[model samples]
Each structure stands twice: as C-alpha cells, then as structure tokens.
Target: MLAPTHYPLEYHDLRLVLALVRGGSLAKAADLLGQDVSTVFRAIQRLEKALGTRLFDKPRSGYSPTPLAEALAAQAQQAEQALARARQHTLGGEQVQGCVRLTCSEAVLQALVAPALGAVLEALPGVELRLHGGPGFANLSRHEADIAVRLCQQPPQHLVGRPLATVPFVLCAHPRLLQGDGGGAPPWIALEEGPGEDPTGDWRRQHFPAARIAHSAHGLHGVAQLARAGLGRALLPRWLIEAPLQVLDEPTVACASTLWLLMRPDCRHIPAVAKVFEGLARHFTTAANH
Candidate 1:
C-alpha cells in the first residue's frame, strides 16, 4: 500500500472531535456546537476521510470514539487551552475589545442591568454587550453565555460567582385595587414558580392560604405589570416597586434571596468579558450599599 495520506487537523476539526467526545452522540454534539445533527455527521465524515482512519464506532447507544480518536481529542483539548491562554495574554486591559454575551432573568435586566447599560457601554467603548433576558438560566458550560446574573439561594458550584445583593420580597398592589377592595386582602396576582425555584411563592402559599389567585405570571416583571394594572395584589421583589404600586405593610414575609454575578472560570480570563463583569459588579455593589 502507498504511504498513508497525511492531513493536518484544522481548528474546527479539533472542536468537532472534542464536542463529539464530550457529547457522546451526534445530536448532543450538534447542540453543543449549535449546528444540526446532519451537519455534524458530515463534518465527522470529512474529518475521518482526511485522516484516512475510522475515528468512531456506530454503536447502538452512541458514537464511541476509537483509541486514536480519544488521543486526538486530548490533544485538541490541550490546543484549546493553549489558545485561550494566548488570547488572555494578547488582549490586555487597555486593549479590551470583543463581544460579551450576558444572560439574566428579565426582571433583573429591566430593573438593574438595562437601566445602567449606557454607563457600561460608555466605559467600554470598544466592547459590545449582548443581553439575553429570560426565565431560564443560560448554560454557561455549553458556551451559551459569557456572563450571567442570577438570583438564587445558592449558585451553581461549577461557576465562579460573587453575591451582589439581597433581594427582599414585598407585597404590592395598585392604589385603585386597594381602594376598590376596601382594606381586606384583595385578589392575589400570584407568581408562577416556573422551572427555577423562588422561595417567595412558598411564603405566599404558607401565609395566605385562603387568598384567591385572580391572575398569575411567570416572572417578577410580569407580576409587577399585573399588579400595576390593578388586577390583584402581588408579592414581588422590592426592586420591582414603582409608581402607582403601593407596598402593603400587612403579611410581611421575611422572604429573601441573593443575587449573584457569575461566569465560567475560563471566560473570566478574556479581556472584554472581564471588563463587563467588573462594570456590572460595581453597579450592583453600589446599588446594594444604597
């Protein structure tokens, strides 16, 4: 046989192999790479052809890597680490420039981050911030986001985080709704405890078992709006209290949770990501003190 065809692995090829090794199957690998299963399959085929060797076995359970594939994947991981270190060194503090993705719950975004975004952008003129606001937490391990702001009793162990503030829960209602109800417990605008746990819901149920839930929302922003609309009384985070919505003194629950700013350890080394992280940390730190 002629000498085996020699081909060098590309950056994308390394990423693909590592993703497949970590994800175990094409579908999971596609999800990690943000590509379709078919695309990932074709890429694997191309990589195998280039190397002139079978890299994976099509087992019933999943794609199992061969001995050579595992060795190649290990090298790919080392390469990735080296590249990350190089980027960290190349992008110095003054040279901070890149896009940083930030993810957080909608309530936090509207009340905190969004309002202060102008100042953040002003400080880091060369950096771009992409904010994602939703109820669910973004998977940082999958590179879904570079930074995250989360309100929780305890943050994930894998992420590096700092507690920013203590979010206190308060019962609020529109002046008009309270006036119409005439001093008794007005119908409740309940907060729906979605996938993430919020202790405030438990506090509401434990304290106001007989209260009727006239309307419900999945987030603090939604519940605040419902309360503002004179729909019903809502137990909400104190930060959400605004014009027209009055905080009720009765049934004061000592419910609270900490707000945390988090990021993957590897991402913290990037200049742009670190700059934004510092800016936001300062914002929340100042807000908490006041």
Candidate 2:
C-alpha cells in the first residue's frame, strides 16, 4: 500500500466522501461536513485528481459512490477509528508541555485568543500554540483541532464545553466619520458573506434596509480597520475593539453568537488540553463580566 501522504487522501477528505454518499445530495453532504456546497465540491474534485480516479458517479438524483470510492470509504472509517485511539495516545503528556491546536474565526482569535495567549505562553514555556483561523469552523471530531473558540447561539452537538461570553455586535464608528457639516448616520461598512452565508448580514440588510455601503470586507479585522480609517460606521463585536473607534447609540441585533470554549469529548481529558481550556475559560469569563 502507498504511504498515507502518498495516498493523498486526508481524514477530512475521506469523511467528505462518506458524507456525500450517506447524505445523497450536495446540500446534505455540506451540512454533514460542516462546510458549504462549493467547498465540498472543490474538495471532492481535488481528491479525485489526487487519486487519478473518479470516485462518484454523478446523476440527477444525487451523488453516488463508485466501487473505488466504496473501498476507500471503508478504509476511511478504519482510519477514523485508528485516529480516535491515536488521540488518547498522542495526548499522554502534560498539556502544558505539548502542543495545543486551537481553531476559531479570525475575529475571535485576534480580539480574544491572541491577546490572551501572551500570558499563556509566558506562564508555560513548554506549551506550543498552533492557531488555526478561518471562515469555517474546524471539525473537532476528526481531530482537526484540540480546542475551538466558537461563536454560536448553541454549540454543536458533537462537542462539550462552557459558554465563555455572550458576544454581541455593536455599532462602532471612527470619530472622524461623525465629523463634517451635517451630523448624520455614517455610511455603513458591510462585512461580506463567506462560504456559508452569514445570518448576521441578512439581519443587517432587513433591519437597516436603506443603509449605504461605504466599504466592504471579508473579515471582521478588515472591517474594524476600515472603520478606524474613517471609511464608515461598522457593526463590530464588542470585544474586537480596543480604542480609536467608538460604539454608537444605534440599536442592533444583527448578530449575537455566544462564545463557547469547546473540545471533542475524546480529546478533553488530556492534562495539557485541560489546562489550556481552563485558562481560556477564565479569560473569556473575565472579559464578559468586565
């Protein structure tokens, strides 16, 4: 058999194939994979190219796996089981001495996790941090991450953790934006949609139907930067702002996903994971109350 890397199929890619076969449709597979349809499509295409074989037979009803895919899917499930066993084995040392993989949206990492890590790194010199940030939530079940800082009303059913904070988006604008002859609502800086449609963007569109777009950005940090540069008013999460921009009096419920400090059940008891988890919990709790 080819080595794992030479095989070129990753754990997530294998799961995607299984998900597509089981879900029977692109949408359903996307849901199962915790990704958008485009992403699922792209990943499958990439996998097929890597293997130099078409794994799925396409038809109107839905995606159906071929013989090669069936065999691979079986292997994938076996790999998953092996990974679970490996999970317990890999995390045998003190969490403080080993590496911890953390996943979160860019906004959370920059505003919360990144700022707090200085203390964590200072206190535990042996601990290594591998921060993974993106638009999509990483799959804890597949060992994509050891911990996740998620912003959602309810945490996913697969993970377990505590509510770190109620992160609410508030209207904030640079002081210069409010300047000039007539005082009026500053043009809005719109946060653009990602792979999965952001519910908050729709909420903003509905609530402020007439708002003008002064700028647009794909990430919260970009939006905050634009607002700081006096582009326009921006609805930013409360924790993301430190200074220069001020929260406005305008009412907004555009987006309010709770911050959750979560870990896969299988990975949580590791001493190092536990220690870092506790520190993150304390940091967010303090940020929330303050």
C-alpha lDDT score of every prediction, in listed order: 0.79, 0.73
Best by TM-score: 1
Any runs in candidate 1 off by more than 4 Å, and if so which?
A: 1-7, 16-41, 48-81, 84-93, 180-185, 251-253
Q: For residues 1-290, what per-residue lDDT tens digits would candidate 1 score against the true structure?
A: 12277786688998898888767789878976889999999999998888888888988998888888787777776776667557657876565566788888899888877876778778888787767797766667655677988777888799889888887888888988767545666899876756443767777778888888889888778888999998988878887889899998875647888888888786666667878888888887787688
Highest lDDT: which candidate? 1
- Model 1 CA lDDT for position 221: 84
Looking at candidate 1, the ten consecutive residues that score lowest on lDDT are: 1-10
What local lDDT score does residue 159 receive in model 1, on the 0 to 100 scale? 89
Instruction: Tell me the tens digit of each residue's lDDT in model 2 across 3-87.
Output: 2346645678789887776566788788767799999989889888777778888899878888877777777756755664466
Q: Candidate 2, after superposition: displacement of residue 59 in Å? A: 16
